[model samples]
Target: MGIHDLPHALAVHLFFTLSSVVIGLVLGVTLGILLSRKPKLSNVVLPILSVFNTVPGIVFIGLLLLIWGMEAITVLVALGIYATFPILKNTYAGLISVNPQYIEAAKGCGMSQTQQLFRVELPLALPTIIGGLRMSTVYTVSWAVLASMIGQGGLGEFIYAGISANDNGLILLGAIPAAVLAFVLGSLVDLLQTYTVPKGLRKRGSTK
Candidate 1:
């Protein structure tokens, strides 16, 4: 079936992908900010996140299945876990990369703590954060395919059926759209960076 005919499948994929990205971003950024404020936490959290990142995606899904037993929630939770590390690492890196002098200047200008975060720190860190978000998006979309193993409808259904039935055309139908979706998402993120990044930062090659 074409993607249009599989609206529930599409919606499931979209929900899983979007929810993973958003949750990953929120958790990642929050933890990243906390780490920046407390370098001692880095010795603890960074290693843990790194270990999680090293775990294979399928293994994570399998563990989730063992706990949740083939539910839709298992799919989302697995995908979300897979989506998190990149955003977390990158957000921490971005915030840390901000020059001390720039922060001092903001303080010199009497910017409040909230104002400094929103206007100075976040704007400066946006490119890196977005880059992490792009990575999470691709990861989430790809991982959502595994949801079909648990009886959730997605493009993976076509892939699984195609493989079982030896239908090359059906396999291509799923593979093609998945590839296109990833490409489109990556390109859209690039476009966002181009337009949304501060002009000076873009000119300085910091936005890329």
Candidate 2:
């Protein structure tokens, strides 16, 4: 492929990465909140999800393809699930890690459970939760390339086509952009942490 084709491929790559990350983030954060509220659920749910995480990306995609067929939904769902684990773990940890003192303080202020969660807990958890998002985004960028294996077409098209043709330039063209894209997206997430995290916790880490 030439420079002209790169734009279309990049769009496809972004679609695969962004769509998956968005779904994963929402689901993960919601699940995390539930797990924190009912810690016992983690004992049952986490291990099962962990098993899914351990599965190789390609194998997972292939399995999903059997059910969803060689369709875009298959790739989106596979990549989204792949992206969910870290965020879910971090969100739960961040929420539960809040100090008892803080919880008591909020309660003393007459803040209800939901009020405490939104105004105090989630704000404090921002740093760690943002870190999870960064991880998920970077990983999905690499994984999204797998979209091409099933004909969805992303940078993987170049990578795989280059491999078959033994063309180093084509391989580098694909690999470099993907690596750069991952780094750029990760950096953006870093910038986001400053704005997302509570100002109080910016310097002093959140306590347990």
Candidate 3:
């Protein structure tokens, strides 16, 4: 790899990781909130999405490439869909598990369902949701590497080339950066959890 390659690889990796997560978070959290409003719907939809998640990443991306061709969008869509699952599940889980007392209190304050959802349930659910984000971010970093397989650029090119040439050094050049990126992104999400979650709710936060 050229000395200049690392910076370019880093940029590509971050773009893929962050972009997919942003798109995924919007779709996932929206679906999750919709499902949370209807237990029966969550039961049906969540299971279907979970089944999709069971498909291997490469296989899924390969299938998408047939329709989308070898563009970055194909990779982004696959990664976004993959990243959505945990966040959707956690959002539903977190909102459902909010204390009944809090719900009652929100009602007592004359808050409507929407207001209560925005102000009370979501704030309480922030830690769990952010935990899911951390998971998605880390997982997306790993998955983004596969983008190189389809001609989209990332550290995967280095790894794939290293494998082709049977050189560990080249593989490390790719892998070590990917690992550091995942760790750093995951850590940032954790730090976000502390800030985004309300200070009062922070003490009471529980994924359960």
Candidate 4:
């Protein structure tokens, strides 16, 4: 392809990355919260998730491709599943890590279980959850390149073409933008972590 194709390719790449990440974030956080309420179930489920997480993105995508037959859904499902793991694991860890004192304090105030989760636990856990989002966003951007394998259209087109043609320049065209996109998104997540941190925690950190 030529330089002119870059804009469309980039747009397609963004669609795949953002859509899958959104799907993953919602599913991961929801499952994490539900599992957090049942530590025993989490013990079984989380270990299974970790095993699945060990699978490579390319292999995951290829398996989905066989089932879905080269559709965009195939790519989205593969990418979304990959994106879900980090967010789910981190959200679970963050929720469970909340200090017992906080839980006790909330209970002392007669706070409902739901209120304690929303008002206390979730706010405190936001930083760790955002960290998972950062991981998912960056990894999804890289994995979005696999879209080209099924002719779904993305920066990967340039990457695969470059490899076949033995042209490093073409490969860089895809790679550079992907790296920059991941950096920009990851930085945004960092900003989110900063603002979402509880004021008490911030004060404690500042004093130290």
| Tens-place lDDT digits, model 2, residues 17-107 | 9999999999999999999999788889988988989999999999999998999999999999989989998998888988778889999
- Give the alpha carbon lDDT tens digit for every residue of 6-54 in model 3: 8998899899999999988998788888998999977888888888899
TM-score of every model versus the real structure: 0.90, 0.96, 0.96, 0.95
Which lDDT tens digits does candidate 1 get at residues 34-92? 88778888989899888888888888888988998988888888887778788888888
List lDDT for all candidates, in order: 0.82, 0.91, 0.89, 0.90
Please give the clash total of every predicted structure, in order: 0, 0, 0, 0
Q: List the residue pairs that clash in candidate 3.
A: none
- Which segments of model 4 are wrong by more than 4 Å? 203-208
Q: List the candidate 2 regions with Cα displacement exceeding 4 Å.
A: 205-208
lDDT of 2 at 205: 53
Q: Which of 1 and 3 is the better model by TM-score?
A: 3
Ranking by lDDT: 2, 4, 3, 1
For candidate 1, report its TM-score: 0.90
Residue 68 C-alpha lDDT in model 2: 89
What would the per-residue lDDT of candidate 4 be over residues 1-208, giving only the tens digit for each residue? Answer: 9779999999999999999999999999999899999999999999999999998888988888889989999999999999999999888988998888989999999999999999988887777788899999999999999999999999999999999999999999998988898899889888877887887876652211
